[model samples]
Target: MLIGDVARRSGVSARMLRHYESLGLVRPTGRTEAGYRAYSSEDIRRIFHVESLRSLGLSLREVGRALDDPGFRPSELVADLIRQTRERIAGEMELLTRLRRIGAAGPADWEDVLQTVALLQGLGAESAGRRQRAALSSGEESPVPVEALVEAVLNETDPNVAGALRWALERSGEGGLTLLAEGLGSPTAEVRKRAVQAITEIPSGEATTLLRNALTNPDLVVRRYAALALGARGVADAVPTLIDMIVEGANDVDAADALSALAADPASADEIATGLVGRLAHGTVEPSARRRLTQALADIPGTTASRALADLSHDEDRAVALTATYIRKLRDAR
Candidate 1:
């Protein structure tokens, strides 16, 4: 059978069949004289198994493992799948609980309820009910007081949900700032992170302070995110901290990102490039750091950075040599 025939028989799309093939999940059994790929009945069975496992949310890697294991037990896999599904339900329930608290003041208007109903109808009542059932089974909270029809605007995974929440918080007046600040201090890391992100979107002075404090979080992941948030906020106060991080942090990737962010400001670019040149001239920085610093210098536009790059053109490091080329481009453009 051709790919299309296998797709028809197994109820998987031909594009998905090709993706499975690329992932090494399936292969054509043979090829015709004209070079058309062929598949066997066995391939159809394999496709069915792949599709079934996919429907259970098993990743391609997990499905591949199950397919490769001769003694793989479907019952055991199904049990694990059920466990994962339950965990997901529990998480959704927690989100729903938070959403309910936020939306407890009642719908913004009748249109809100109408929109929620429309969304639920679009998703289909049966499918939405199944999700609610899963949430209930996992002991998660509903987004709204109504357990049966929790408004998803507050609990949705869509990016728009964050924006919507921020708008609601702002419109809530003074209480909204307090609520957002409280959320920032929430024990839940996700809530804290989201709160910070949402606050930054509100264009308040407190938001800048919150992001600055987040940059010093014990968690490197959180710090990186905070750095990114600060950059997005474009707070001039953040530039010094970002430059310090680039100079002192062991996490080169994060440091590089911070440096890139700081370099966006012309004053910051001059300061960092000048400081790097001084460090390189004094032999105070390591070769790798020097190389990174040179790269940073090349990132800044203007005569100062270009001149610094021109001075380092004869450096022994290949990275420094490459940076000199980049600097030359800047100078040439002038």
Candidate 2:
């Protein structure tokens, strides 16, 4: 076949075929009497082979090496191609996400688009200061998208940056909660904890619901955060974990305060007292734990906590007895 026929048959343009010849990727095997380039069957087959390799992201030069180099191994080259393809896909996806967020901001013009783009870049910057500034600015006229704030909040490790992200998420509204709820199921415990903390700051009913769901999260920290948030919201369901946190001495003071919030509601007071009383009566609770539990009862309004404090006042551990006695005197004074 002549160059034109070869190009027509193989879908390789004549100019490309000539360029391939110049690079020795594929050369015409013969020429006609008018000195036209002509390709034999084998040459046409090589041309198809080059096109096939190029489709796999092979550079034309790589295609040349692949077809002509006897010592060339395909395994490493194929793996490299896979890596490069994944990187390209990741970059494109990142771009798509940025565009979506910018669109989600409801930008009215190119100026809004540019501002959103700058904020998005800031949110992803390596410097914690930049990320923090981005998070803080997220509440301005055209806020950064909630999705980006959630993404930053979940991945942020620097305490200041994380706090700023949470604040920004709170300002973005409840849309960030969906992403945060998904983070609650993340395999990484820290991410799960961050998800709960982020939700805790959201202060919406949806956030409260997510926190209630997270109360059962397997991670202790996640459970504790959820419990504390739910308790503050006067959710009696958090009473159990608050009691557990008291006994475990894990943020026990905060736990006690949350319990106090629950107890502040007359409906939940006796139930809270009863729950605290049960932990105090457990056989294995140490003197220190018992003391902490005794202190936790100070805010309970009903007879259950008062009576539990009365019984604890004469306990064998003098420290527990004195602590309970002090608490009882205070309750009496109240």
Off by over 4 Å in 1: 1-191, 244-266, 275-289, 302-304
Lowest lDDT block of 10, candidate 1: 137-146
lDDT tens digits, residue span 1-334, model 2 = 8988988888888998989999988888898999999889999888889989999999998998988899999999999999999999999999999999999899999999999999999989999999989888876685898888888889999999999988888877788788888999999988998988889998888888888888877888888889988988989999999999989899999999999989988879999999888988899998788889989999888888888889989998899899989988887887
Residue 197, model 1: Cα distance from true site in angstroms: 3.2
Please give, for residues 40-76, the per-residue lDDT of candidate 1 as tens digits: 8888888888878788899999899899989889898
Candidates' lDDT values, in order? Answer: 0.62, 0.89
Instruction: Determine the backbone clash count of candidate 1.
Output: 4
> Which sections of candidate 2 miss by over 4 Å?
none
Query: How do the predictions measure up, each by TM-score?
Result: 0.44, 0.96
lDDT of 1: 0.62
- Every model's Cα RMSD, please? 21.3, 1.4
